[model samples]
Target: MAAAIGALTLRATRAGLYSRLTSGVQGVDATTYPVLSGLARVGPVTATKLAEAIGMDRTVATRYATRLQEAGLIDRRPDPADARATELVLTAEGERAVTALRGAMESFLAEEMATWPPGEAAAFAMRLEHLTESLVQGEAGRSC
Candidate 1:
């Protein structure tokens, strides 16, 4: 599933929309904002947990987090519950970036789907939401 998603993602931005939209940021790419948004969406969490939630390897998640940290987009603070662990959270800058990224994506989607019938787009979004919820539930079942 990840492989298929990865392959699709690689081609999804072939037009370089993400790059063009985020041209001012240094060392930030399409992956950077998504990872940052994932962190913000999940709130404060250990890198390992965040990785699992985002379907990324722990090492890769750490690398992304580290990059964002270096870029001042995120901050890592000591976990109050765990002495040896750290919690990742989005910095103010990160939050702004996530907000902008989400807005941009939504705007782009709206324009692209403007020609589609309203019900069809709504149905597609609903179907996607249901699928995502099912997957999350299935994972929770397995974890328990």
Candidate 2:
């Protein structure tokens, strides 16, 4: 299972599909994709929480957040709960980017599964999501 996942990642990287997918939105690479998606999932979060949610270092999270803010995809606002901390939130543009990214990924997978039976494709997607959720929950702090 691990090998299969790794192989899929390698193939995507080699094919530059990750870059292509991000390019469909705002020229974000694979690395920034996680940050954007993380914000989309749980925005108005401190950099530390965002980092934890995405399995990224706090510093890197801050950097990515900065870039996204500059791109107008994300915005940094004062944390009401913590006067000294800033919360990261996705802007309208960020939401659009996330939506576009999802579309790009779904389109790619849809193309790949076009030849497969509908039931098989659905089952594969469900199982993969379950596996990923389990892995992520079990290894919260570890990058997979």
TM-score of every candidate:
0.74, 0.79
Tell me the lDDT of model 2 at 107: 88
Which tens-of-lDDT digit does each residue in 1-144 have in candidate 1? 787656645766543776765665654686675578788888989999999888888999999999999998899999988898999988888778777777777888899999998689989889778977887889889987
Where is model 1 poorest over a 10-residue stretch in terms of lDDT? Answer: 6-15
lDDT of 2: 0.84
Candidate 2: segments with Cα more than 4 A from true spot: 1-3, 11-15, 133-144
Top lDDT: which candidate number?
2
lDDT of 2 by residue, 18-91 (tens): 67788778746767888988888885799999899888999999998888888889888898887999988888
Pairs that clash in candidate 2: none
Cα lDDT of model 1 overall? 0.80
